[model samples]
Target: MPLIRYRTGDLGRLLTEPCGCGSQFCRLDRVKGRIAFRSALPSVYDLEELLYGMDTVLDFSARKEENKLCIQVLLAEGGTIGPVREAIEARFPDALVSVSSTLCLVSTGKQLIN
Candidate 1:
């Protein structure tokens, strides 16, 4: 047997604080969302799975603005935006996430004046 180097792409939080149960080992928080890899964001299908899978995500459209990645989404009723932002930011730190009712599309579909 060997130590597998496979990445599960499962997103979770590392808990450093001591627990009340007196467990010595650090705990891994429940899975929040998933990404493609540790160094890069997920693929289109993976992004779809990650976004649409969330209860907060109702509709979405992605576009690349130079080095910036943007995802505009519509949320379900009473769904807070924090979790949606976190789910995206946690996986793709480079993304400039903006969740709003407005879905804007560039006419040229290209970065102008860049």
Candidate 2:
């Protein structure tokens, strides 16, 4: 096989440092966003990582409404809303986070936004 560079549209960092497990091979950091979603502002990939990092969030979608960001989330059973709202606020100071039982999905069944 020949070496080729392919664009996967994922945005992330490459780690050069050895891992705590003692592996020296470089590792790609968590994907931050897709190239198609690139913009002058913070990438939605970062926000997705933050929301999904929470144990309760089952799914989520985010959109810009006027001057504020609206985040709708689906929670796991017995999930609480406070933490999700806090995480989004902390990361995006100006955003308005809303917790919901359902979020719209595309035809492919993926969450509509990031």
Candidate 3:
């Protein structure tokens, strides 16, 4: 079948050149985030990438409430909140990071943001 252009809802860069591994297929660089979840600062997918860099954070969700940005996080067992909070604050100076055992999910099974 002939290849067709498709929208995957993910934001990323497409490399048209052949890869160093010798493959001729186009390569996708990094997937930044989904189109629907973009925000004024960064998308939840971007924030998730940042938080996941820390071993303590298992899951997280960010949303804007009123005039503040609130981030809810589910941490690993025995994880401390200090480092996670610091990491988020360092990147998003004004964000409110909250630690929780669980985070809410939307009907589609993705984290919910309001």
Per-residue C-alpha lDDT of model 2 across residues 18-111, encoded as one tens digit per residue: 9989999987665545323224355555666798799999887776666666678899999998988888778777776777777887675655
104: Cα error in model 2, Å: 0.4
After TM-score superposition, the amount by which residue 94's alpha carbon in candidate 2 deviates from its true location, in angstroms, is 1.5
Top candidate by lDDT: 3
Measured by TM-score, how close is model 3 to the native structure?
0.67
For residues 3-114, could you state the per-residue lDDT of candidate 3 as single tens digits? 3223223456678888999999988665654323225556545676798899988888767766568889999999999998888888777788899888888766766655
Candidate 2: clashing pairs of residues:
32-45
Tens digit of per-residue lDDT, candidate 1, span 11-110 = 4666778989998887766544323343554544456668889988877767666666677777888988889889888878877777677555447442
**lDDT: worst 10-residue window of model 2:** 1-10
Better of 2 and 3 by lDDT: 3
* Model 3 spans with C-alpha error above 4 angstroms: 1-40
- Report backbone clashes per prediction: 0, 1, 0
Model 1 deviation from native, Cα RMSD in Å: 11.6
Report the number of backbone clashes for model 1: 0
Task: Compute each candidate's TM-score over C-alphas.
Answer: 0.53, 0.64, 0.67
TM-score of 1: 0.53
C-alpha displacement of 36 in model 3, angstroms? 12
